[model samples]
Every structure is written in structure tokens, then in C-alpha cells.
Target: MKDIITNIIFWVVGAIVLTVEFTFKFNDTLGWLLTTIGVILIGIGFIYKSKKPFKYLIEFFINFF
Candidate 1:
């Protein structure tokens, strides 16, 4: 119950921040960057939930870099 409530609160706060970003003439670039990061996080969460091996992917990138 506590976890669910916390998750709901977090989502609400995130939504409010995004809303403020749009309503006020703040830094658009920073807002876009935040949105992009949020998208990446969602994708990663999906991949992790699906049991995909992400460690190998990270290792491959590390090797390339």
C-alpha cells in the first residue's frame, strides 16, 4: 500500500513539473532533455521487466568506447 501511494505521488509530481515546464517560459532545451531521459528510463524499465540481458549490452558499449 505504501509503495503504491509513493508511486502515485511520484507520478503526480513528475506530471506537475512537466506541466510547469510547458506553461512557464523556462528553459525549453532542459525540458526536452529531461523528457528524453524519462523516455530512456521507461525503455530500460521495460527491457529489465522482460528479462533481457542488459549487462552484455553495457559491456559491449564499454568495450567499444
Candidate 2:
């Protein structure tokens, strides 16, 4: 399913971005950039009606912010 694949991609990307942000102790600008992108991808996944993964991502995003 296209939706499944898309959500998976977004989920993976978001996870990677957040991981890099936390692991590197980089500048705030880079941190914010990654955070913003991760949030946007998760938000798009929600908009596109991704199911369980999206639900979990939404919960993570909520707690993340």
C-alpha cells in the first residue's frame, strides 16, 4: 500500500533526524531544523490518514514538543 510505504518512510526519516539531533549536541539551528522537519513529516503522515504508525508518531511528537 502506498500509504503504508509513505508513512514508513516518514517514520524512519523522523527517527533518524531526531536521533542525530540528540546524539550530536549540534547547534540549536540544526537541532531546530531537524525537529521541524521531523514534526512536519509526522504531521503530513497524519494528514494522509496513516493508521497505527501515525498514531504512535503523533503521540511521540506530542511528548517531544
Candidate 3:
């Protein structure tokens, strides 16, 4: 149940990102960056059993934003 929720969340987020990337006339660099980050997130979720290390990226993004 938890895994299903996790994958769903990842998929939804990825889809939203791709939609934004394709819909906007924004920076190509930023679009590719979003796609890469989304792929990395899906990879990490598939490859790992735990979600502990995500805090690092989350914190980084928080600071980045």
C-alpha cells in the first residue's frame, strides 16, 4: 500500500513536470533539468527501500527555492 502510494506520487509529479516543460516557453536548460531530476527521483524510489536520504535533496531544494 505504501509502495503503491509512493509510485503514484512519483508518476503524478513526473507527469506534471513534463506537462509544464512542454507547455511553457521557458528555459530549455530548466526543462531538461526538471526532466532529469524527475527521472533521478523515480530511479531512486525504484532502487531503494527507504526514503531517508531524500531529506538531503529536499533540504537543498528548499534552500534553492
Candidate 4:
């Protein structure tokens, strides 16, 4: 149940980020911020089973940098 809820939240956040990205014209810094967040959420969703979302989140940070 907890995993399900976590995945749902991640999906919702990712969806919102994508919608905002498409619906508005943000400046480069804000755009990169949103994109980074969206990607982190997605990557976390993909690797949530091992309690390693933080690891995946850091991976996203590395990639974005």
C-alpha cells in the first residue's frame, strides 16, 4: 500500500511538471529546475522497490549537472 501510494504521488508530480513545462514559457533556469525535478521523480518511480529513491534522485542530480 505504501509503495502504491508513493508511486502514485511520483506519477502525479511528474505529470504536473510536464503539464507546466508545456503550458508555460519559463526562463532557462526555471525550466531546467522543473525538468530536473520531473526526471528525478520518474527515475525514482522506476527504482522505488529497493528503498533507493534517494540514490536514483542523486543520480538525476549528477546527470543534470
Per-residue alpha-carbon lDDT of candidate 2 for residues 1-65, written as tens digits (9 for 90 to 100): 88778767876787787787789867878878988887787666555554565667678779999
Q: Residue 45 of candidate 4: its Cα lDDT?
A: 66
TM-score of each: 0.44, 0.62, 0.54, 0.64
Error in Å for residue 3 of model 1:
1.3
Rank the candidate models, highest lDDT first.
4, 2, 3, 1
Instruction: Please write out the lDDT profile of model 3 over residues 1-65, one tens digit for every residue.
Output: 88767866776776677777678835778978987877776655543445565775577579989
Cα-based lDDT at residue 51, candidate 3: 57
TM-score of 2: 0.62
Q: Could you tell me which residue pairs clash in candidate 2?
A: none
* Model 4 per-residue lDDT at 48: 71
What TM-score would you give candidate 3 relative to the actual structure? Answer: 0.54
> What is the C-alpha lDDT profile of model 1 across 1-65, one tens digit per residue?
65445545555555666566567636768878666555454444434433344875576569989
Candidate lDDT values, in order: 0.56, 0.74, 0.68, 0.78
Where does the lowest 10-residue lDDT sum fall in candidate 1? 42-51
Task: Give candidate 4's whole-model lDDT.
Answer: 0.78
Q: What is the lDDT of residue 8 in candidate 3?
A: 69
